[model samples]
Target: MKRDYDIIVAGGGLAGLIVASSAAYYSNQSMKILVIDRNAIPQQGKKTVSGWVCGDAVGKNTVDYMADRIKISWGYPEIEHPVKGVIAYSPDHETGISFDGEGYILNRQLLPQRQLRDATKAGIEIKERVALRSLMVEGNSVIGVEGDDLDDKTAFKKTAQLVVDCTGVTSVLRTNLPIKSFIQRRIDRDDLEATGRYIYNFELAHEDKTYFDSDYCIIHLDQKLAPGGYGWVFPKGENKVNIGLGVQQKAFDTRNRVMGVHPDLKTLIDEYVEVNPVIKSPRLADGAGDEGNAWGTWQVSVRRQNDCLVANGYMLVGDSAWMPKPLDAGGIGPAIIAATIAGKDAVEALQAGDTSEKGLWKYNKHFINDYGYKTAGLEVFRRMLQGLTNEQINYGMKHFLSKMDIDKITKGEHPEFSTVDRLGMIIRGAMNKKLAEDLKYCATINKVLVDHYHNFPETPEEFSEWHKTLTGHLEEAFALYK
Candidate 1:
């Protein structure tokens, strides 16, 4: 079958737009690309409240490149709110720790829309209200995609030399890929972080006294409220804040059953807001406080980065590749990095006249080396934290874990602990033996995993053996909690 385009990118989210834009940028506008999205492109103010906290050099560079192309100033009111620090609260809400850092509470939709506009200007075609149903496969290789035009309810088939799935966590195309493929069949529910969030304009009881400092974001480690996850308050601006809670699916289900209520994210957020001293009687930004303007609820995969991001004639980017950072469910950084590489690889593969899995193997190799290695450590850290009770976390945060350590981990780097630092931490952990053992075990497991990822197979031929070792390490890391 003759391909309709050189590349058909599924889902016009941040990742897809980046792929299209970067492909055009690197290929010098030579590649023909099409981006299909189920919903209309988001406009300013018609977006959910979310933040992208990235302090890494790669993330900043990607954003700068995109900003230059999109012609938008990349800070405050226009793109995102500059954040200076974060405050973490214990489960009891009695004790808190403040950490200095740098990030942004992004205007999630604005950045993507800007990128979409740039892609269009670069000659990439985009279709809105087009829902991808499945891939069109020929002998184990993806040839194209079949989707529905929701506006007209018409089915259409568009063939391409390469198909890239940038669809979010519920990626229809990724799941339908051949079972023999290296890509994961599905994301485990335990690995999913189910979240509900609301963006609200604070209605302070006293104008003189504000609830929270706008300069710093807030994280609530109250497992009783979030249950195996955390709650967050990210400043959208001086007046507006995005408040949400996330929990692992199993814990959420258990909490619902025990509470004898549906226990949806909305219910959890409402309960937290009503009783919390800082945010009582908040008003929705949309002026629907009484009726409650729910931004949305969704699930994000926080698993270790997929070992296989490429298959025959296809690649998975962003959430489709399970690239969200486990520490805080941050994906934009990794997604941008992956998409940029995928775009470059796609261009190179087309030029080389070999769009097979092996042709695109560099995408997988580079991604693992650039981003996946560090994420392995964070995933281990997340698993370790999941095993701890609220009291233990509070104690550890207060005594041992420093702001610098968290900053390094979040930026996709392993925490550096010198002998003096380790000794100090060990002395502190002596107060809590279980916490000490768990922390030491997690550190060892994290080192092993990070080292393994650094040594990821250079070619697909070595994947099977490398993956076996990888799985064994993951099993051992998970067992630390068990």
Candidate 2:
């Protein structure tokens, strides 16, 4: 059957733009591609009416990866400000572990404008103000998508050989897929976080690095303040910062019950900002690039990517697949890597004339090896961290992290503490037995999950057994956290 387009990219966000550009580059501009977005031209990929609601930070290496392969890069106003690293602090503010190298605090609202230009330059057609509703399925394989054109109340439907879903976390297309496939249709409420942030330009109240550090992104781990999540102060300029926090629902309720206070995300965020000792006389910085993006709240998936990312003529990218890192809930880096790989894989699969699950399985294997492999382990670690009390967290961060573990963390990898000497473990365990035991258990399970992911099925045939094994490992980890 002749399709409407070679590829139809749903959601013209960061991931969708990159996927379209990469596909066009790899295909030598020979294939026809279209990007459908819900927002108008100037607001191409604006996430919501609140504007690109995100933490607005990404690692430098992630951008470098895209530049090296796709030859696309960002600079100036879009890149915003560069930071030395990310420093995560303990609840008591006594211990801080830097978890990453150089990165950038982006202007989320402006980045998409640049992305739209790049996509257009790469020969990809774009249709704005179109809200995608669902995948168009024929038999068991996806053939296209159907939705509404927000301009008028007109019904819009389009067919394509392949459809790339880049819709955000609560994607209607993802949840309503008509195919019987391995891709998980819905994310659990427990695994989702209610995150909110504000872009503020403030006078410096003090020079305390713990509260606000211009050179680094500061993350504060206080269960009473954030509840199973964390608060962040990421600098966008010398005196401007993106400040926010995320909270897991169950933990949020528990904290509310214990404290006898009913506070929503906005209330929690206001309290977080008010508690900061370094930000003084803060005002919303919504003038230039942050117009509608000054303050907003959104949900993020603190879990691994979907077990399977592709099915026949359809592929999932970015938040639609829950590609955010479980440890810190950072989504940009993984989305960049996954979208780049998906574009090339999609091109190859299309050229091969087979869009079956077996044919497109390359996306799954390649992404797993490149970045998805370590996520499950991180998810396990995140769960363990969420289950800890403020005291346990403070003690663990102070005593558990060693030089080697710090190095691993700085490289954006999980710290494997299983190799610590038995004597040292015994001594540390003696000091804080419960914390040490829990950390050891998390490390052991993390290692197991990473090794299992290393052997991810080469094709769809072995996926059942492989997924079953993964499910068992994760179940044990989840039970421990509970």
Candidate 3:
């Protein structure tokens, strides 16, 4: 069947769903949106995503302004992470930080579905079991898409006036994108982490028992404990939890997918469940990480480096676009900001009635102004931090950043944590001598991010200059490695 729509949104993930739902209200009402997804949501689907990073607030705001209406199929927001920020700890439980109430651990399935439902009701169409195999391009521009059924051999062809590459990760519309080629690229594989998890309905053996709050997420960061990565316990209210963890990617060795990775997550999970004595787990961790060594594997995530993602007609968003933050590669916060720009700019271009490459270039400029280029430098910093020793980490965490503490940085207060400001703090604190230099170096790296962020281009022409500045500082920073 030949299907024609104004927009064909590939991969019905949060980013895709958001761009569709959010733009529905402000965009030209004559436009039609088609959303595609693989897995079938349960009878109950929230319009927003609810996880540790995503939540109801982000969902509601999108729905209120962008979605504009509530319906099972048309307009809505996605994700719902209800928990407060994080309470972190190490293997020995020696070092810990209670982030104090920060943000919610969203109900992942709830919000996106809610938004999808809203989109459908708002006149957006959904194509389930449809996976985009490639993009249909004519000369320099994208024309439409060709898709097929995920569970069947049905071939589907769809055409759109403007093709939106909402296909996360496997973006089909990237070839038509305008990617830059003249940058020095470096990838760190030793630092890669592969993670997997499962969602289960926990049933208590003892009746009349109640779970507390139903909105807290527990994170484990102890090195030797989880090693290479960390574990997360996310609560989705009403006694449901999304329990998972990420392990060092190198440990998994995906080349020969049969063997398991280290710290067998299944064992860790089983031990934790029994250790609790009260909570029961109906699912376990098993994936490329475990080689099917555990019970039911709920989810699996892989993180690697992408050299360059920018292209002429397409822009990457969410995971498919590799837009995770360097700190933890978390997407919820960053995607909200990026997606807001991508959606708004696309809508604006449509309103102007011009979908040219030049019109779409604003998305790149806007992102670079915000995080595109900063992530480049931060990516370098992630490499440097991963190679350094624990002493180096603890020292830098305590002293160098001591003056530029996150609490203060987030509050818009200039960091007072210079080496001079930290002399007393550093001399008496952690770093002995060998690690001090790295801390000093990290301080300089921090300066690079600050400078780069402050000096990020105000326009697209300046983007090339911004990359030059970032890569130049990154070269100096990379020299400090090893």
Candidate 4:
């Protein structure tokens, strides 16, 4: 069987482009790559809305490294209206905690199109409006893909030495792989974050306008409103903002099934927007103005679980590999890091003429070490938060925790409570026993999971034992909530 290219990347999303472009740009121009996408290139205003917030220097470095390789001539956009920090409100909308930090709001559509232009310039072949049908597999290895042109319905078979699935969460190629393969057969609903966003632009007379700090983002936490998740407002600039709510499907479905009050997410958001103090006299943005409508609704797997990310002649990147942060639902940074690693490894494997599961295993090793370990602990924390009631959360926000504590936790640094601090927390807990117990339990589980991830196996041979240990820890952790 003649191969059509050195690599065939199915799906031309951000991660896919990064994989193709990185390989072409960094592999000394030696590899032939093809990127097939179901949709045509999105126009400037028609693309999806997204934003990135860098938590540390590593994130910024990853972005810069990839940009250099891709030869992007444009200067990285400045952090427009830099956020001073995030102010989080309790479910009661009374208690609030503010954390000081720095982050940027991005023009989502512009970022990927920029990458695509660089990819094309790097000589990676891109075919738009081509939908991936399935993987071309032989025994345990993926060999290529079967796809068709969306407009003409013209079918095509393309073979390659390696096939990378950069397809988003609903990956047909990855899902179709044999159950025995390393990938998980399905994403559990409990692990998924279902989100709905509405972006609005408003013009208000000076006296009529309500004030919101454009320098800070806001998060509203109310399980009654979002169930297992939270709502957020991120400003792109003055008078323009992204507002949305996210709920874990498992919790959302369970509540609806038991209570029989199926709250539509979009309707809830609309109602919130109407009464929200800061959003006075709002109108929908550009194309969304006619119906007073929302920009979009989407889902992503937010929990980190143990799954094989690589198989013979195949690899997964971005959402296909479930690389998003469990706590924040941030995927841009992880996607870039994963794509860069996968691209370099894929090119090396091709050069060595060994695309076996064992040969491509380094990509998985690097990811688990660099990114996966951190997210595993966050997933545990996310689950613990899901188990808490609104009153419990309000109590914590009001009495024990502060913004600096949250900043420490976000940076993977556990907050250190001094004896005096512990005494204060204990005194606060005495006033509310159940809240105290829940806080203690959450702290214990957080330590347990964080410790476990820090000990992740270094090689494939040790993965099974380590994974077994992880499963046992997770089961025990979840059992505590029950």
Root-mean-square deviation (CA) per prediction: 4.1, 1.5, 7.0, 4.3
State model 4's lDDT: 0.69
lDDT tens digits, residue span 1-482, model 3: 23386666666766776667655755744567777665454412221132212212222332233333312122211233445545444443444444444455444545565656666766777777665777665666565677787677788777765666655433444533323432112334443444445454465445321222354455555343344456565654454455555555443333124334334656655545454333564543222222222233322212222323333334456655566555454555456556656666767766776655566666666765655545654555555545544454444454455423555433322333456444644365444454555545565666666666666554455667766775687677767663
**Lowest lDDT 10-residue stretch of candidate 4:** 50-59
lDDT tens digits by residue: candidate 2, 1-482: 78999999999999999999999989998999999999998887787778788998998999999999989999988999999998999999999988658899888888888998888888999999998888899999999999898899899999999999999899998898889898999999999999999999999988999988889999999999999999999998879999999999999999999999999999999999999989999999978898878999899999999999999899999999999999888999999999999899999999999888998999998999989998998898899888888988887787678878888777667886643444364545343676677778878888899899999999898999999999999998899887
Ranking by lDDT: 2, 1, 4, 3
lDDT of 4 by residue, 1-482 (tens): 77899998887877888888778866877788998877677631122333221221123444665666565332344233456667778987677667665555555545556767778778888878777888888877788888787788889789899999888877878778852455675787778888877666765334221224576777788787777888877775688777777888777777678777877877766766765676767766654221232367777677773357888888999888888878767677688778887888899889888988778878877776666666765776678678777877887677767455667655544433222246454555443555555556556666776677666555557778877887897787767654
- Give the alpha-carbon lDDT of every model: 0.73, 0.90, 0.51, 0.69
Q: Indicate the residue-level lDDT of 348 in model 3.
A: 74
Candidate number with the higher TM-score (1 or 3)? 1
State the displacement of the C-alpha of residue 95, model 3, in Å, after optimal TM-score superposition: 2.9
| Model 4 alpha-carbon miss at residue 380, Å | 1.4
Steric collisions counted per model:
0, 0, 64, 0
Q: Tens digits of per-residue lDDT for model 1 on 351-373? A: 99888888888888788876788
In model 1, the runs with Cα more than 4 Å from the true position are: 42-62, 65-78, 92-99, 206-211, 253-262, 287-294, 416-431
Question: Against the true structure, what is each candidate's TM-score?
Answer: 0.88, 0.97, 0.73, 0.86
Our tally of clashes for model 3 stands at: 64
User: Any runs in candidate 3 off by more than 4 Å, and if so which?
Assistant: 1-3, 39-81, 150-152, 170-192, 200-216, 237-240, 251-310, 369-374, 388-404, 408-421, 424-434, 453-465
